[model samples]
Target: MNLQGIAAVVTGGGSGLGAATARELARRGAKVAVLDINAAAAQSVAEAIGGIACVCDITSPESVEAALARASAAHGAARVLMNVAGIGGAKRVVQRDGSAAPLEQFRRIVEVNLVGSYNVLRLAAAAMAKLDPLDDGERGVIVNTASAAAFDGQVGQAAYSASKGGVAAMTLPLARDLAQHGIRVLTIAPGLFLTPLLHELPEEVQRSLGESIPFPKRLGKPEEFAALAAHIAENAALNGEVIRIDGALRLPPR
Candidate 1:
C-alpha cells in the first residue's frame, strides 16, 4: 500500500487527530474525504486539504452508507478508512447521592465509540473487498481509535473505558475476519493528549497532566498520532495489533 493516488476516508476529520490524519494522507497523494457530523467543521478541514467533505453519523447505517457513496463518487472506493469519530463521557457507577449512573450515558458512549466504529468498518470493508488488490495483494487498511483508559480507567470513567475497551478487544478478531478480503484492521490506544477538550483547560492543569507521562513529561500531539496512522497504512505486516502512543503514561486510579 503505497497510498499514492488511493482514496482515504477519515471520520471525525473536523479537528484534532482526525484533521491531522486527513492532511497527512492528502500530503501523501491520497484523495481524502473528511467525514464528520459537524458539517461546517468537516467542510473547513476538507477545504483546507483540497478534499471533499461528507457529513456522516457513524452510528447509523443509512448515514454511513450515504457518506461512503458520496466519498466513492468523489474519490473512488476508499482503500484507507480511519475510524476516529467518537465522543467521551465520565461517570461513576454510583454518584455522590448514592444513585446509580445513567444508563443512557453508557449507551451513548458505547453506541458512538464502539458500535459507530464497527458500522463504518463493515461498510468500508465491503467496498474494499470489491476492489482489485494492489501489488502486494492488499486491498485496504483500517485504523481504529481507542483510549488508554481502556487498560486502566480512573474513577468516573466507567462508560468511557468500556467503550474504548470494546474497541481494543475487537482488533484481533476483526482483523482475522477481514483477512480473507485482504483488508487489515488495527487499533491505536492513545493516552493523555492535547485534544480540543484538553486545550480548553487552564494552562497549569494542562501542565500537570503532561507531567504525569513517565518520560516525555508532556501530552501527545495530534501530528504524532497522524504520523503513526500513516505509517500503519504503509506497513503491510502491522495488522491486528493495538499500538499505544501514550508516552508511557498509565492512568492512576482517581
Candidate 2:
C-alpha cells in the first residue's frame, strides 16, 4: 500500500508519537487527519502538516464519530489508522497505607487506553473495508500503540500495565478477524521514550532513565517509532504482530 494520495487518520496527533507519525505520513504524500483531545494542539500539528485537525475524545463514541466524519469529509475514508491516544498513571492495587486502590482509577486507564483504541480501530477499519483494494487485496492497515510495561510492569503500575496489556493481547485476534477484509493490524510496544512529559523531568532523571536501556543508552525517538509505522504500512506481509521499539530494554520490577 503506497501512502501517496491516500487518507490516513492518527489519534493523539497533537504531540509525541502520533504527531511524528502524522508528519511522516504527510511527507510520504498521505492526506492526514490529526485527532486529539486538545483542539489547539491538534490544530497546530494539522496546520504544520497541511492536514485537517479534529478534536476527539477517544473514550466517547459520539466524539469519535464526529471526528471521523470531519476527517472523511476532508480527506476521504481513511485507509491507514493509528490508535495512539492514551493516558497513564501509576497506582498499586493497594496503596502504601494499605487502602485498596480506587476501582475508578483502573477503569479510567482501561477506558482510555484499551477500549478507546479498539473504538477507533473498529470505526476506521469499517471505512477501510468499503474501499477497493490497492494491491494484493490489501485495503488498509491499523497500527496500535502498546507499551513494554504490558509485559514487565513495575510496582505501582497495575492500572497502566493492565491497560497496555489488553492492547497487546488483542493485536493478533484483531488481525485474524480483519484478515478477510484485506486489512492488517499491528501493535508497537515502545519502551521509555523522551515524550513531552518525560522531557519535563529533571535532566538527571531523564538521563538515568535513558541509561537503563540495554543499548544506545538513550530513550527512543518519536520519529523512530513513526518510521517503523511507515514500514508496516508499506510492507503488506507484516501483519498480526507486535513489534517492540525498545532499545532491548526489559523493565525491571520496582
Candidate 3:
C-alpha cells in the first residue's frame, strides 16, 4: 500500500511507540489520526504533524467507536490501522502476601492489550473493506504491538506476557480472515524498548537493562519500531507475522 495520501489511524498515539509511528506516517505523506486516552498528548502530537487527534480509551468500545467516527470525519476511513496502545502491569501469580494476584488485575491487562487491539482492528478493517484496493489489490493494513516477553516472560510478568502472547497468536487468523478484502495484519514483538516504563527506571537500572542486550547494548528506539512499521505497511507480502526488534536478546527468567 502506497502511504502517500492514505489515511491512517494510530492508537495510543499520545506517546512512545504510538507517537513515533504517527509522526513517521505523517512524514510518509499519510493523513494520520492520533488517538489516545490522553487528549492533551494526542492533540500535541497531532498538531505537530498536522493530523487529527481523537481522545480514545481503547478498552471502551463506545470510546473507540466514537474516536473512529471522529477520525473518519477528519481523514476519511482509515486504510491503515496501527494498534500500539498497551499497559505493562507486574505481579507474581502468588504475591509475597501469600495471595494470588487478583483476577481483576489479570483481566484488565487482557482487556486493554488483547481485546482493545481487536476492537480497533475490527472497526478499522470494516472501514477499509469499503475502500477501493490499491496496488496488488491491497485495501488496508493493520499493525499490532506485542512484546518479546510473550516468548520469554520473566517473573512478575504473567499478565503482561499472556496479553502480548494473545496479540501474537491472533495475527495469522486475522490476516487470513481479512485476506479476501485485501487487508493485511501483522504483529511486532518488541524487546526492551525505551518506552516510558523503562525510561522511568533509575538510571543505573536502565543501564543494566540495556547491557542485558547481547549487542548494541542499548534500549530499542521507538523510531526503529516505527521504521519497521512503515516498511510493513508498504510491503504487501509481509503479513500475519510477528517480527521481534530485540537486538538478539532472549530475556531470561528474572
Per-candidate total of colliding backbone pairs: 0, 0, 0
Q: Cα RMSD for candidate 1? A: 0.6
lDDT (Cα, tens digit) per residue for candidate 2, span 1-254: 89999999999999999999999999999999999999999999999999999999998989999999999999999999988899989888878899999999999999999999999998889989999998599999999999999999999898899999999999999999999999999999999988898989999999999999989899889999999998899889999999999999999998
Roughly what TM-score does model 1 have, to 2 decimal places?
A: 0.99
Superposed model 3: Cα runs more than 4 Å off: none
Q: Model 3, residue 20: displacement in angstroms?
A: 0.6
Put down candidate 1 lDDT per residue, 159-224, tens digits, no spaces: 899999999999999999999999999999999889999999999999999999997999899999
The per-model lDDT (C-alpha) reads 0.95, 0.94, 0.94
- TM-scores, all candidates, are 0.99, 0.98, 0.98
User: What is the C-alpha lDDT profile of model 3 across 1-254, one tens digit per residue?
Assistant: 88999999999998999999999999999999999999999999999999999999998889999999999999888999999999988888898989888999999999999999999899889989999988589999999999999999999999999999999999999999999999999999999989887888999998999999997799999999999999999998899999999999999988
Clashing pairs in 2: none
lDDT of 2 at 177: 99
Residue 126 displacement (Å), model 1? 0.5
